[model samples]
Structure formats: C-alpha cells, structure tokens
Target: MDLHYVVQGNGEPIVFLDSGGADLRDWEFIAPSLAKSYRCIAYDGRGAGQSPSPIEFGDYVEDLKNLLDFLDIDNTVLVGHSIGGRIATDFALTYPQRVSKLVLIGPGLTGYQFSPELVQRFEEIQSVAPNVEKMAQLSLELPSYQVVMTSPQRDRMVEMTKHNTLRGLEWQHLWKNLQVWGELPAIPPLNELRVKTLFIIGTQDSEDCFRIADLFKQVPDIRFAHIEGADHMPTLTHSLEVSSIIREFLGESKL
Candidate 1:
C-alpha cells in the first residue's frame, strides 16, 4: 500500500516496526542513535500513521515486503516492538534470506490468548472506539503504559495512540474479517530460525508477554534482556538502556 516510511544514516540496514495501534514514531529515540552507525528505516503499518487501512491479515506483511523490495535492502536487521515484533517474526519466517538478525521487544505470539480480564478491557476499549481521544486516554491509563514514561514521552505516546485509534475505527467495520491476532496459522518452530535473535522485555510489562518470553527458550542463538521497573513501552520509557543493549548485541553478533 505504499506505506509511509523514513530512512536515515548508512551501512547495514535496520528496519524498525511499530507496535499495534502505533506508527514509525515508536522508534523516535532509539532509531536516531542507531542511525549513526546503521541505516535505520521506520515505517507506519497498514491502518496506522499515514498508511492505508488494512484489508486483510496479510496486508501488513505484504506492505513490509514491498517496502524492502522498493528500497533494495537485503539481509537487514529487523527491530520490532509489540505487535510489530510479531510482524518481524512472521516476515523473517517467510523470508529468512532477507533477514540477517532479529531484535524483538515485548513481542506478541501466535495462539497467545488474552486473559478474561484483559479481554473485558479490550471490549471496553472497543466500546469507546468511536471516540478516538477517549480510547487513547484510556489506553494510556492501562497498567502497561502507566510506568516510567516522562511527561513529554507520555504525550507523544498519546498522540500516536490517538492517531492509530482513529484509523482503526475507520477500518474495523469494513475489515471485520481480518484477524489482528493470530495472523500466523501457528508460531513457527523456533529451532528453524537461522538468524541470530534478541528478545528484550520489561519485568513490569504484561504477564502474558512474559509467558511468551518463556517460549523463546526453544530458539537457537537467542539472547534475552529483562529490564527492571520498566513496562510495555520500554522503548519509550527506557530508550537509552534499550539502545545500549542493542548496540552491544550488534557488536557481539558481528563477532
């Protein structure tokens, strides 16, 4: 769909994927620092930012493929946050030769189900879906977002949340058959993944996500970092620490 994207710096390319209901700005802090040594590309997913509303589950994956082809980027590192991480995982599985490595932060997994209470909250969020601002505000109040964000960072998050919320409202009714979760038929067996992988999560993030982290133990050549006192949005709340860890991983992975 000709997704909106921005590219900076040079050298080995690193593509940044945003969380669900988020845009390229999700990497605002981390991308710039990495760009000093690597080409950093951040893009809006279908139905988010300036990208068009998604018509099917495969749309996000296709958009990414098209973007990479257009840029003539190959064997790039993919860094993704939340649902963005899930998309990266799927892309790597589908096009392993195109990906050199993966860095997944608070990634979602196929077949992962939300707890009953969380499902209720999801319904509540959808109930207020028509009011994008209210939905965004409520989302910020969720426990996952209530930790460690500075005022300015929180404001930026709210802005991105609202933008995504509005797009979702515009698309959901028309694309009701599209499955947001479980875009993959099943989680690919981790042992089959050939590229080096890093999984980072915040101790204070969702317990469900922590469970998903446990599944990654099966992945060969995988490294993990657990950030203390941070939450779901650590890329925003703990940008410096996250960036440092990524730089170290890149250097060590090269060796």
Candidate 2:
C-alpha cells in the first residue's frame, strides 16, 4: 500500500485508523494485545508519521480500499478513532459489504456540524501559523485532553502531536483542513448504517462527541461504550480497557 502500514497476528482482520494528527502510535498499547487474537492493520495516514503527504485533497476512504485490495482482505473489522472514525464511517457507508463490523472512538462525522467553541479553539490553534509548537500546545488545550494531559501518557501524546504538527505544516496546504476528507456531499443517516457497530467515547470528551453518540442510536445494531476518566486519547490512557471492550465486542475469533 502507498500509505505506511503494519500488519500483525493472523486471525480475522481488524484495520485501525488513528485520529486527525496522530499515527499508529495511538494504538501502540491496544493493537499489540489484540494482535494475539486478531490480525491487526494499523496505518499512518497521509502526511502523518512515515506516510507520504497528499498532493491534493486526500481520498482517505479510497486509500483504505486500495490497502485492503493490496492486502487481499475481502471483508474485515473496521476500527477508527477521531478523523479516522470519519474515514471508516464514510467507507462503511460507501462500501458496507466490505465491513463485517465497525467500531468508532471519538469519531468525527462526514457532514456533522461542529460546535462553534470547538471551531474557534481549532482556529486559535491555527492562528499561531507555522509555529507548530504553539499549534500543537493549543490543539491539546481542549477539555477532552485534560485527563491524558495529567496521565503518564501525556509525554507520548505531546510528542506525537508536536511531530505530527510539524509534518502537517510541512504538507503545506496539501493536508487541507483537518475537518473534512474527500467525503461525498451526502452522508447517509445513522439509521442507514447497516454494519454491526460499536461506538465509544470518553466520559470527559467534547460535547460534540456525546452528540455523535446520540446520533449513533439510529443504528439498528450498534453498541455504545464509555471510558471513564478518559478524554480524547483513551487508547493511550486506557489501552487495556479499550482492548478488552473491543475483544468482547469482537468475541473469540482466532486463527
């Protein structure tokens, strides 16, 4: 695949998509554990980590399709976090047959309207411009990161944020706005999400996250989960819990 990716284990496949500015580092704790029971695929999206920068608006969903085609994975589990969740959501909506199951963690929707406060906070972070350090610091100033900021994973999160921030800036406008990928104008209602799904969010995350959770209720076959004491990056702060939740949802499928 053109995107930098790692595959592990050998059971049912599970493709992982990280947050907007994060890389495979977000799943460092959880993916390895799950790798014991499920084949895991984690990739660094364009302009993040080792992945090459996108020269234009990125078709992340299409990129995912290419990756699956490259790996010869016909149908598998889809696990996405943040913007990655948005990618998975769109991909599932566009190609439902390819996803046997779907899991979202603090995901952004394709056409969902974000709160003004959230928009402003992000804008403030961008106002700092090319000074990626300031941009990275402000990006994590949201209420959602409060817990992780105080946890042991704070340094790792910070490190990844800073590094990715630099990479994003280096991509120059090719990265586009972090909000929207190359999404179709129309996003099918949650009621149309036919694949079995699991929606997870941190108890301390943004209001928009909770709002998204409420929307997921329209899905006929979906489970909702919460991570207490976690904000945005629960995969880093509560890896074991998240892993266990996923394991339970996915059941005992093995090699």
Candidate 3:
C-alpha cells in the first residue's frame, strides 16, 4: 500500500485512525502505550501526511481496507479520534466483521447535520484559501480546540495542522470542486451500528461533539466516558487517561 503506516508490538491488531488535518503522529501519546500490550498500526490517511492524495471521495475507507489486507490482518480493534472516528465508524458499518471493538474519541458522524455556526466557522476557514497559514490559524481557533490550544501540546498541534494544510489544500480544492463524493454509499442510521464501541470525549469539548455522543445512544453496544479538563486533542494532553480507558475496554483481548 502507498499509505504511510507504523506498526508496533504484536497481538490482536489495533489500527488507529486520526482526525482531519492531523497525521498518524497525532496518536503519538496513546498508540505506543497500547502497543505495549497489543499490535498497533497508525497510518497517515491518504492526502494527509506522507500518504499521497486520493483520486476519489471515498478512498479513505477503501484505502484503510487495503492497508489491512496488505498487513494480512483479518480483523482488528479500531481507535479513532474526531474525523478519524468518522472514518472508523464508516469502516465498521461497511465491514462489520472486520472490526472487533471500537474506541472513538470525539468522533464525527457521516450523515449527521452540523449546526450553522459550526458550519460557518469551517466556511470562514475555507474562505482564506491559498493562504495556508491563515487557514491553519482559523482552524485551530475553533472553540472545539480551546482546551488543547491552551495546553503544552499547543505548539505540536499547530505544527502538524499547519503542515497538513500546506500539503493538502490542492487535493482538497480539487475534490471539493468535483463534489462527486456526495454520491457515494450512504451511511446507515446510528442504531444500525453493529460493532461494540467505547465512546469517549473531553468534558470541555464543543456542544456538537456532545450532541454526537447523544446520537451514539442509538448504538446498542456502546459505552461512554469523559476525560476531565480536556477538549478535542485529549490524545496529546490526557494520554494516560485515554490509554487506560482503551485498555480497560479491550480487557482480556490482549493476548
């Protein structure tokens, strides 16, 4: 596979999917801790980091499948954050048997409608366009990132996001103009989710993230947890807590 991926330890496989505008390194804190117990694979999604850009809208999902196939993984545990959580959810819904358990941190839902204000915020970011530095600054200014913006991880978050924006704008501009992605397979309703899941979010996260958490209530086998004093980038600020919760959820699966 052309996607850049990192693998560690050895046991039941655990693949980490990261948020938009951030690469596999976003999982730097928690993935290694989990790797000590179970095999962990963290990859830069197509167009995000070292991976090349996608030729189509839904390539992220298929690229993930291909990555697993390349690694000879029959099934795996998925750990995803933000948009990464959205990808993981879509992957599980599309290939139920391939995912054993899910750990989604402040995930985004494919079919869910976002609020006008949040939508406008992103639109403003896009309006800046070719000025990637301004685009990157506007992105991190969202209240959803307030907590992490004030934390020690602030610099790292800024660096990764700016780098992603610089490398990805061209690809994003191409696909956003084509708009063929909306024609892809529809995501089933939240209740139709088949994989057992652990949904965690920071209490300080945006209202929309909490709203999405409420939506997960439709999934029968889901559990919820909150990390105190954290916002969207808990993997950077609350690594120990995130890792511990994931380990507890997986329980005896670590062989």
Candidate 4:
C-alpha cells in the first residue's frame, strides 16, 4: 500500500506510531530532534493522513510487520501515542523478538475501558462538531480533558483528525480488535515481556489511564513517567522532553 513513512538519522531503528486520529505529522517537531541520534521512522496510521483504512486492527498490525520486513529492521524500538501506543504494545506482545524497546505516550491500556457517559459524550462531540473548531473546544472543556496543546500543535492534530474518524466501524472496532482486544488482552504481564517498556503519561490524562498504569505496576522491566503539566498530546507540546527520554532509553539499550 506504500504507507507513508519518513526515516532519518543513522542508528538503530525506532518506529513511531501516531495517535489514532493523528498522522505521522504529529511527530514532525519531535522526530527531527530524535533523528539526530537514532534512525527514527514515523508513518501515518490507517484512516489518517496518507494511509488508507483497512477492515480491522490486525490489518494495521500486518502493515507494521510488513513495513519492518521491507525495511529489514529487527530488534527495534516501538514508540506509540494513545491508540498508537496500544498498537505498539500489541505488536511487541505478538512479535517479541522484533522489538527491543517500547515507549508509550499517554497510552491507553486495554483495561482502560470508557464509561458509557464518556462514550456518549464522544459521540455527541463527533455529531455536533464534525469540524476542527468544535473538536478543539471539546478538547479544552471536556472534564476528562488534560492539558491544552499549543495552538499550532492542536491545529495540526485537528487537521489530521479530519481524516482519522472511525465512521461505520462501530464502538467495538473502535474498542476491540476483531475480538483481539479486551481486559485480558489490554493488560499483558510485563514479567513475560522480553523487551524493556516505558510508559509516558500526562499527569492530566484521564483518570482511567492512570488507574491502568497503577494496575500494571507488577510488570517487570516496566517504568512509568508522568509528564507534569503536559496533557494527552505531550508529543506536540513537550516534544523535547519526550525525545530526550526516548534517546536516553535507546542509548542505554544494546539493540
């Protein structure tokens, strides 16, 4: 499918996955900085930017696997944000040998199911706004809201979001992965995980995400960092800090 991707720098592979509604552009600022130290690879997820939507989340995973195979990249660092983080986690779980490290930003663990009211609000937001202004407004006012991203970053995210909606996919497809995701799948035992994992959560993120991280504390080789004052989109607002952590982790890892 020729999924759009940008590769930079001259070191070990680091594949970046954007948030569900965001494209590779979300990493524009952060990626360049990281590229100076690692061979960072960023690409648009399906249904966003230059990528096309497929029937299932597994298709998205297959696309990632194929991309790695084509690039001859093994033992890589998989970095993902939001739904992108979930995707990275899933890929690492399924193909442990291919991933040497994982960095999740404001990641949504499987156990972090949405409340009925929150789901309804999401639907309401989509129905009323259907455009960038309303969406940005919702981003600011929503109680579950976190820190408000900078205008430029918010604008870019909103622009990419225009192409990232889930239309007729239903809540399950949006939530579950062809029956591949659930409480059982969402919270995997990191004790069993061979790769080192890092979770970067915005201190202002929805409470459910925080609870999920707390729940998974038993997982070995897993660490969590709270980006104080940063919200859901730290990659946009706090790119430098995010990039520094990634670079440090990569430098310390053998792969």
Tell how far residue 29 is off in model 1, in angstroms. 0.4
Q: State in Å the error of residue 79, model 2.
A: 0.5
Residues 117-200 of candidate 1 have per-residue lDDT tens digits of: 777777678778588888877777778777844545877887788888888887777755645444436667877777899999
Writing each residue's lDDT as its tens digit, candidate 2 over 1-255 gives 679999889899999999988999988998999999889999999889999888887789999999999999999999999999999998998899999999999998877778879878877887797998899899888888999999999899999999899988876675345554233465457788899999989899999989888877898999999998889899999988899888889885332
lDDT of 4 by residue, 1-255 (tens): 477888988887789998766788779878888777679899886666676555555466778999999898877889988888877877887899899888888776654666666666666666564465566466455553445444456566555555454332333345443332233434665567667888888777777668767765755788788787777778887787887777776664321
The residue pairs in collision within model 1 are: none
True-structure lDDT of candidate 1: 0.84
At residue 190, candidate 1 shows an lDDT of: 73
| Residue ranges of candidate 4 with Cα displaced over 4 Å | 55-58, 126-146, 149-152, 166-187, 252-255
Candidate 2 Cα misplacement greater than 4 A, ranges? 175-186, 253-255
Q: Where does candidate 3 have its weakest 10-residue lDDT segment?
A: 179-188
Between 1 and 2, whose lDDT is larger? 2
Best-first order by lDDT: 2, 3, 1, 4
List the candidates' TM-scores in order.
Answer: 0.92, 0.94, 0.94, 0.82
lDDT computed for candidate 3: 0.88
Candidate 1 segments whose C-alpha is farther than 4 A from its true place: 55-57, 148-152, 177-184, 252-255
**Candidate 4, pairs of clashing residues:** 110-186
lDDT of 3 by residue, 63-169 (tens): 88999999999899999999999989989988999999999999988876777798788778877887988999999999878988998999999999998998788
RMSD in Å for all candidates: 2.7, 2.7, 2.4, 4.2
